[model samples]
Target: MTKGERAGADVAERAATGRAARDRLPIDGHGVFRPPADRADPVQIVFDQEADRLPDLLALRHRRMRASPLAFYRGAAAVMAADLAGQPDSGLRTQLCGDAHLFNFGLFASPERRLVFDLNDFDETCPGPFEWDLKRLLASVALAGRANGFGRRVRAGILSGAAQRYRTAMIRFAGEGELDVWYARADVDDLVTRLAKSRRRRVTRVGDKARARTTLQAYRKLTTVIDGRRRIVADPPLVVPVADLLPTVDRIALEDRIRTMLTGYRSTLAEDRRHLFDAFRFVDMARKVVGVGSVGTRCWIILLTARDDTDPLLLQVKEAGVSVLAGPDPVPDPDGEGHRVVAGQRLMQATGDIFLGWQRVPQLDGRTRDFYVRQLRDWKGSVAIDELTPRGLRTYAELCAWTLARAHARAGDRIAIAGYLGRRGRFDTALTEFAESYADQSERDHAAFRAATKS
Candidate 1:
């Protein structure tokens, strides 16, 4: 075997034997592999109590980080620390999608037009405990399943499958060569076929077909242009007009800045596609409100058109502050926060849009904020959580774990992780317990949020 391959085998053997080199991973003040103590306080309560003032709550969260990027990092760290305080852990750290809740999983079109399912959000992504991501994911599974009327046993079964898949994948990864682990990926078509073979029920076939249709529909909606507007237009509260949301001066300034940012952003693209950037010019800009977790964050969609009015591209410039899991008063890295989002996304996704870039813009309040830009609606879509049946949700959860494992494997020593997990089912069992416990915690937090709002 080649040297690298041999080393991989050695690592795998050590991991499989449960006696690999034990290195002390990073830990917070709470003696856990999480964010620092101050940042981990029950902000959920604050978030819950101020539901009526969601903008205010979001603004409050933003303001804490606005003092400096480092401050935002610290704030995020605290939130994560708090969230992870009582949770069980795997003790394996990898670059994680820090907020891996069930809703954060989704289907997006790959560069090849194939609908691939993966973790769709990365606002809180960073190197940390694998368990952190798994915990958030499991909790979300339970919360969403309960919300959708699934019984506890069904939810537990789903969680068990998810945990098992992650552990099994890790163990398999341990035995593979470094290159193999790095290159491992789920083929969406193959995945569908595998699912079809697992259970031969009419419901399974119908659900699979329905999911495929929904994905195609979302792709069409994302790419469709409305009149001269190249964006998904708002239908009031659900999709508010960006034009109605911004101040007149800020709106004008944003249009000017977007044009400038796009020019700079284009330079980051490959040489062959650089010509495409010149054909498009920014025509309009507005804040297009989006997402449950990102409700009040500053997210704007910029419209661009070629010489003719019909050929258009929609770009989303989203604010990328410090992660809510990073803790309060984080030290600012001079490169800017937008770079963080771009870097993290590039690391996690198999392929990303050509227009991805970062910009630092001075806000109306005199503070400069970092933001990452990308095509706003280029075949982006998600499964409707409320619409999923119990079995569908379970299948979907396994898909998320498979994708997450692929992403994590890309950035870390997959063999070491795989070895740590071992061939036995210990890790899966631990995660199932962790999931159940964390799900209870999420419900408690959700209730706390509701009660905080009520009081």
Candidate 2:
């Protein structure tokens, strides 16, 4: 870091901030609801993305989307991205969790084993408009409320209340200095302490569930001994051993490919992370179907045994691809998709997995792919939004909004975004209006998705 480099960095940040300020000038508070007449068919976008995915698992992805509009929304980031592009944007780039839906926020263990809440999924993460992430989140609130059988009034209330929190939090962050904003976090302990008794109980229950989701529990649930060798159990389409899912040739080459990938992954880690990762010996791996949207994508769980057989570690290696947020205004990712994901996750999360890193490796057929690796089990758990009552939903919704604001504050131009979102309800109202309209589109998309899967 030379003086010239520091000056250049500061100037670049000011330019980005200037862009964000300009974005607000063109788009009125009510201008966010522009659903273009030529908005592409959501179903077609899903199908196009399916081209890079495992063909056999497409049915599972479709089935998941067919379950409900919220489920459909969860897997429809591409659709939303397309739709959002037609809407007014702030043009302020930030590290986006491209699919920042209701379900994407979750409880995960920090390195110290403390429960912390933040945006948990990042397969489609990239630098993009701050408004894009907020729109996705706001729409999810409406869709989740709909799935819970909430009326339009209640759904409207949820969106408004959540937007208020987001606005207020951003205002609060704007007052803080640079380092203060960067160090902010959503610690579960602090959250629980602020809640009423009933709400506290609910938070504790989710926290307990998160704590129970350890690597030991994952081992018991996903593995068994076969011929005196520990191996992942064959559970078709859900948690199948690699050999059971892939062709003989692909299965035969799996070990070597994984080894090489891990080697490259190790090289990407910081010295301490690499040192810790090097201690674990690769024991086995399995292709696992995970999440509603991620079903068709290549995701693997690799087992590693520490000093003794009882000491085990599980690492998840997920394929990274072009982000849904990337389009004509695509932000650059000079380091590659894997690096983009890793960087985005670190920027957005207050604390992240110690094993977080990336690798670019070619598969057996020789197609180079980017994969980001992290501990598969970090005591992660998500609430069932379908089961939340209106009151619970309201409480959960505010927390999510607050968390999203904190993430944006840390990664984007906090002062500019905070200023754009002043102390007012106009921006909030506009976003809620957009969310209601989009919820209807999601239902239509779900119906089409159901028909396509069955056909």
Candidate 3:
């Protein structure tokens, strides 16, 4: 067996035996499974250590060998896995949103044009400890609260509310019927109404109106046709034009590969989408820049035109490689990274895009990289977390909790988790304490990140 495979086997064995390879596992107040506190300040560590190391991190993710198929969870996964190795866990594993920060939660346009909230980023997603996700979520809440100018007391309360909601929702979910839990979703209109009832009326009004306008604007900009070309125009730091980022030779090669990739990607979809792709031809393609953490990664957008002049479809092909959290065992498949992304998305989301699929493309360096394809700018948008008031933050946290429980229910035994939590709210208190402590760590981490970037 290869070294990676042997390592995977070892990890599997260790996990089976309830023993992680790393020492100094963290135990919670109840002496249950928890992450080691020594490395508990992930936000601080990331901020301090990686602020100026974005290029290195990006390079690390792109190091997969040609034709070698390994899941690429990226640098975030490696950090999380090592942190998990040091923590005591409940042995409850699911496809975790490895980087469940506040910004990662967002608004998206569903097929019906109705707004919905869900976990929007999956770069670090993988099968892992449930608490790891909770940690990330809680830390993000604190970090975002700080960023929004909330005082320590208010931030603490927000963190408490978020944890309380998560615990309460999980218990309720455990008692719910599977179908009921499956269908439970928070609509954007309902969320806005709920926020209006809270103390932060001014913030709620502004945020709701802003989100509505932003969503409409995003749809119009993304759907606009230019001479039969459906493409998103780059607006500098926020949106880099694909044409500016690629060399002429690479751009040409990408256009050719996109045509080939679309054909293969469409085959993985349903008959209707396959027929849809078959009816369209590629017109323009470019490397589109996006997201804070994902800024430097290889993400491309392809514009296609239907036989009819007015018909258009935009597709994004994001590069996928071995996950940084490969543990001990590694698998081989040219599209393994893309497959990992596809699998993780299915496991975590209640619903997923119809065009989701994996492909392998030979790079200019004669190496092959795996990538997952999805529609670009199909009513995609996010909330401005920095604008939320304390009360609004609380409401948002509850929504996040409700969504998280629903996601976890789909992949694992909700009953057992709910039972472990019970109706006493002990887990709520415990998590609140954890969040406060972790938030303190995150601030330190953020400062470290700032320092790293400055230096």
Give the clash count for each candidate. Answer: 24, 0, 17
Superposing every Cα of model 2 onto the true structure, what RMSD results? 3.1
Candidate 3 yields a Cα-based lDDT of 0.60
Q: Model 2: per-residue lDDT, tens digit, 127-196?
A: 6777777778888888888878899999989998988898889879877877898888888988899988
TM-score of each: 0.78, 0.93, 0.76
RMSD of each: 6.8, 3.1, 8.3
Worst 10 residues of 2 by lDDT: 1-10
Error of 1 at 303 (Å): 0.6
Would you give me the overall lDDT of model 1?
A: 0.61
TM-score of 2: 0.93
Worst 10 residues of 3 by lDDT: 65-74
Candidate number of the best TM-score: 2
